[model samples]
Target: MREEGKSIDEAINIAGETRFLPVVLTSITAICGLIPIAMNPNPQIAPLAIVLIGGLISSTILSRIVTPVMYKLIPPQMDEKI
Candidate 1:
């Protein structure tokens, strides 16, 4: 975003705003996809469903909160872009 002349806050805000809906919808789809597999007592794939659900929850929280906080803490590298 700095390469596009946006300030740090502007960059973070734009990134967060742009990502929110897609991330939310993707998370919803992942959870929905896992539900049926998770509910069924499959000896083979049931564990995958549990792991995927946990991963989805973890990633959603990180993307929504931790990522923005990290963005605030980490400045763009000087050599990376303008």
Candidate 2:
């Protein structure tokens, strides 16, 4: 987006909008896939699956919110060629 001459804010908004659906759908799919594992009676695998699901939920939410804020707070370092 930066390479396409979009301003940083515009680029971020566009990227975020485009990515929201895929990110959410992927997470939802993974969560659905893991539900059976999490529900299994096997103690070892069930705990692991539950933890993984939790991590995925947290990461998906955080990335959607924090990444854009961080990008805005920290300006990119662009190199200009003469």
Candidate 3:
């Protein structure tokens, strides 16, 4: 929401604070699934593990780009008091 003068910390804090519980739960679920695949000996699970690993890495990278751009475009609420 840079357009409206919201800082990066404000946007991230707003997003994280609003969705904290659900995000944590989802992350936990993903980690649970990922752990099994990551530890599995089966060759078939190897690809799945690789895909998840790649996606996790890619998403981490892209978030740096996406968050700032999104903050610039969305124009966060001014009176929300984040």
Best-matching candidate per lDDT: 2
In model 1, how large is the Cα lDDT of residue 67? 89
Q: Each candidate: what lDDT?
A: 0.88, 0.94, 0.68
| Each candidate: RMSD | 2.4, 1.2, 6.1
Arrange candidates by lDDT, descending: 2, 1, 3
Worst ten in a row by lDDT for model 3: 19-28
Residues 1-82, candidate 1: write the lDDT tens digits: 8778788889888999999999989999989999999888978988989899999989998988998788789875756534
* TM-score, cand. 1: 0.79
Q: Mind giving the per-residue lDDT tens digits that candidate 3 earns over 1-82?
A: 4456767778677765566566556655776678778888998887788688668656655665676578667755556556
- In the range 1-82, model 2's lDDT, one tens digit per residue, is 8877889999899989999999999999999999999999998899999999999999999989999999989968777768
Candidate 2, superposed: residue stretches over 4 Å from native: none
lDDT of model 2 at residue 34? Answer: 98
Least accurate 10 contiguous residues by lDDT in model 1: 73-82
The predicted structure with the larger lDDT, 1 or 3, is 1
Candidate 1: count of backbone clashes, pairs at least 3 residues apart or interchain: 0
User: Where in model 1 is the C-alpha error above 4 Å?
Assistant: 79-82
For model 3, the superposed segments whose C-alpha errors exceed 4 Å read 1-12, 57-65, 73-82
Error of 2 at 20 (Å): 1.1
Q: Which predicted model would earn the best TM-score?
A: 2
- Compared with the true structure, the alpha-carbon lDDT of candidate 1 equals 0.88
Better lDDT candidate (1, 2): 2
